[model samples]
Target: MTTPAVDADSQLLIHRCVDCRRWIHPETERCPECAGELKAEPVSGDATVFTFTVNHHAFHPAVPVPYVIAIVELAEQPDLRLVSNIVGCAPEEVTIGMPVRVLMEQRGDTLVPVFARA
Candidate 1:
């Protein structure tokens, strides 16, 4: 099967290869390992903070300083992770192995998934 283009709604789904059971992020047409068909699957949205950094500089004018940018590992599989912002708490409070859950925030027309302390 062909991989579909990721959009506002589809971003909630994680693509995986049916044959090899390999997870594909950012979406892809074919499985890199086994050339298997890929399918979009829903995740539980539970994750843990694998690592993070508190950015003190504002790269954009509207964004506040000292926001936590973290790599959170999903509960579904090991090493399956996404880069997202840690919310619902202070940036300094975020730590490695911290439990988190996904929360969708409306950004423009899209709902961006962010992690928050669980």
Candidate 2:
């Protein structure tokens, strides 16, 4: 099957089961809850920092040190979260419950969704 196209202006898309009304992450063809067909749906792109860690050591030469890697919970639903890097601010300034908005960045041919302080 062909992969779904993601637009640069679009927020992250999740799969929603029409029958069960359940949201699925990582984009799947079938709903895990009820064997139903799934559809791609756009999210609000608003989130809160659930937890984070500051990486002080540069893992790669191209990447700078003192960056933040965080798990942010979507405002739409509980447990609907994504692992992304927090940008537009200092790593030490990041905190739990901090409000954030999605910012798409082009990495090669893919558009990755990162978060920035709102």
Candidate 3:
């Protein structure tokens, strides 16, 4: 639905400062680096698992136990990272600094970004 994600549905939706070209995770009116205008942009789905936590406690019936919640650093920038889920594998298989690829899954009406082993 989101146009291949544009690159085979592997693109991650984010915002970038038009002036400084700095990627912003939470879009704002002005860029933090240069006060430039922010615009919605798509980035390469390439990323790495910066950190993760496996939840064994079930807080919701819809979500299964032992799911991986991770902070994934985007390949576009050194400090660029976002919170996402690791899928297509067991939670024990995920590790810090592990290479991952983004996938936009249909969650309700939104195509939420999730990561998988690359």
The candidate scoring highest on TM-score is 3
Instruction: Count clashing residue pairs per candidate.
Output: 0, 0, 2
Q: Write the per-residue lDDT of candidate 2 for residues 1-118, one digit (tens) a residue.
A: 2222355456677677889887777567698878999887877889999999999998888778889989888887788777888999999799999999988877777887889999
Candidate 2 lDDT (Cα, whole model)? Answer: 0.82
TM-scores of the candidates in the order shown = 0.85, 0.84, 0.89
Q: For model 3, where is the 10-residue window of minimal lDDT?
A: 1-10
State the C-alpha lDDT per candidate: 0.81, 0.82, 0.83
* lDDT ranking of the models: 3, 2, 1
Question: Model 3: per-residue lDDT, tens digit, 1-118?
Answer: 1222323454666788999899987566799899999877888889999999998999989888889999889999988888888999999889999999987788676677898999
Ranking of predictions according to TM-score: 3, 1, 2
TM-score of 3: 0.89
Model 3 CA deviation exceeding 4 Å by range? 1-10
Q: Which segments of candidate 2 are over 4 A away from where they belong?
A: 1-5
